[model samples]
Target: MISAGQASAWPKFAHILGHDEWIDMPEFQRVEDRVKNRVLLDPMIAEETSKFEKNVLLERLAEAKIAAAPVMTVADVANDPHFRDERSMYTEVTHPQLGPVRITNQAVKMSETNPYVRGCAPLLGEHNDEVYQSLGFTPEEISAWREKGVI
Candidate 1:
């Protein structure tokens, strides 16, 4: 990942970044232009990063002290012991119809209260009548909409 302050970090990436036109621009404008036009940077980073394993690149970035984070795959996050065991990032809950299912736990931990996923999400159109009635539609009108498949 490119640092926002590109000049200070240039020596490390100069070989890969090459002498691009933006290299000479002032720091603020360089950062602004990069953000506005990722076409200027993303391809280069992608090409360079592709040469290294993801974890190796992450380690190199950390060594350079450039703020970077990995875009984790589902399998990576699910299987990582730090997330699965230490932090309890995922947990199994009894889904009403599907039986036990694994789901993400809340990210925040608190001293006063514990929050969790209550249940599986409601089925499609599960609360149609209740929602329509609360919005002032009559039960008959809601049923008519359902029959017409307009819901």
Candidate 2:
């Protein structure tokens, strides 16, 4: 647990990393001692407490909202201006191996433009020659580096 005075200096301390300020902090000593004691005594209790809290929150939320709740259609969501105008929903990128990859604009929209991947994953060193050449390295230099296990 951090003290009030020490917690107040967190922003200032975070900015001065790799300097002597971190070594001079009073909170650092207290935190280190607390961690050491916890590691030595009842480590399982700390692990169980975290899992218990997560389960409790999830159980409460599940009870509040039915597991078989009605699903919303794309039409229902698209009526909202925020979902309709989102730029991420329509963005697409071209991969050298995969051709054009269609990125989903909306998670809920299941349509033709948002089809699953049509190409296989790229093989190892698929663009090694092209990339090295683009970086102004000659073919002979790339071959030498490859032989020496550098590339």
Model 2 has how many clashing residue pairs?
1
lDDT tens digits, residue span 1-151, model 2:
1111233343332222222343354534354543555444235433433454454534543443423222347775545456556533444567676778654444555555654444445679888899999999999999999899998
For lDDT, the strongest prediction is 1
Tell me how candidate 2 scores on lDDT. 0.49
Q: Each model's C-alpha lDDT?
A: 0.71, 0.49
Off by over 4 Å in 1: 1-5, 15-38, 124-151
Give the per-residue lDDT digits (tens) of candidate 1, residues 55-96. 876677677767677777899899989999988888788876
Model 2 / residue 115 / CA error / Å? 4.4
The TM-score obtained by model 2 is 0.27
